[model samples]
Target: MQTQDSRARPLLIYLHGFLSSPQSFKCQLMREWLTANNPHIVFCAPQVLPYPAIAQQSLVGLLEGFLRSANCGPVGLLGSSMGGFWCTYLGERLHLPAVLINPAVRPSRFMPAYVGRVLRPYSGGTQEYRLTEADVDTMGRLEAELAQPLHSRYWLLSQRGDETLDYRDAENFYRSQRQTVEEGGDHGFQGFARYCAPIVEFLFNQQ
Candidate 1:
């Protein structure tokens, strides 16, 4: 027989990509889906700091707070891009399952070009922030601490036509885990709606 805690609604945390916000397309899609089909499940997509150093602090605080508040239910993570990296770290540390979408295996190697001024594509904000070397170093440190795969605890989703970050890196990194590789999709993971069902199953239905 399932205990009350075991049957409690699962909390789903959606971590958006770098330079993105909770209002991102994928985040919004998940929100809408939960609101429509699974009203009992709580969905959260907190805005993370743009810089790696600040984001590390903020993200941890958010997760810690959630863990304390939701004491009786399971929690799952759904992360895209840079957020995927964070999900992997948090999942391993918290011993929770995570679903990564076109995750960045080594963002530190590519963060140099973005060290200066950058625009927020999702939010129509005129403000731009200068990324720094310290930020890059922080990312490097986090990347260095990557946990060995818990194949049963992860689900990696990649697309062959991703233009921003190469999919091969993630494929190679998560090959031992459950993965779904599709053809002719972009960095945004076009047709994301189609995968919504599987994503939900990966997060909540799997034992």
Candidate 2:
């Protein structure tokens, strides 16, 4: 295990939302906030592939590689929307804490209709992203696997008026863990910058 110090506060692995790249607004905001507020923390936002099986495996492998390569111990994960789903799975597997923002708790069920020709967001244009039946099946299995008891290793941040995802889904999934539900904010939390300090404090304050 690596010792924490000025050079390494803690590893903050950020997983961006679906159809969004690692360079999404939320990820950029996080990088900037950390640079200004907590420069010691190492932040990593990897670009995930569009294919579900390949993406999940690649992300998990990358995360493990990062941990081993950096000698990071007890890292924290922060994911938004579909990325939140990944954070949930990784957090469980690694036995680490996570902060999920407007997480997609039931993506397998929710994304069934939008399975073809996904429009990439934040790429400055649209691209034809394929979603095969195999992808859906793999996601279904992942969902079932994730349905096991949560380790109480998460903090869910959700908004009541999220149009992209139903807040109840997160409310139900994280019912056993600590949650902070704000009113009137959309899927992307309104005034998200304001929550950065609090989130960092919460994650780093723990031993």
Point to the candidate with the largest lDDT. 1
C-alpha local distance difference test of each model: 0.84, 0.82
Q: Which pairs of residues have clashing backbones in candidate 1?
A: none
Name the top TM-score candidate: 1
Candidate 1 per-residue lDDT, tens place, 73-181, comes to: 6788999998898898888767778999999889998888878766564666665677888889989998877756553388888999999999999998888889999
lDDT of 2 by residue, 104-184 (tens): 987877666767755556565556577877788888888887765797478899999999999998999899988999989
Global lDDT of model 2:
0.82
Task: Quickly count the clashes in candidate 1.
Answer: 0
> Lowest-lDDT window of 10 residues in candidate 1?
118-127
In model 1, the runs with Cα more than 4 Å from the true position are 1-8, 70-72, 150-152
User: How high is each candidate's TM-score?
Assistant: 0.91, 0.90
Error of 1 at 118 (Å): 4.3
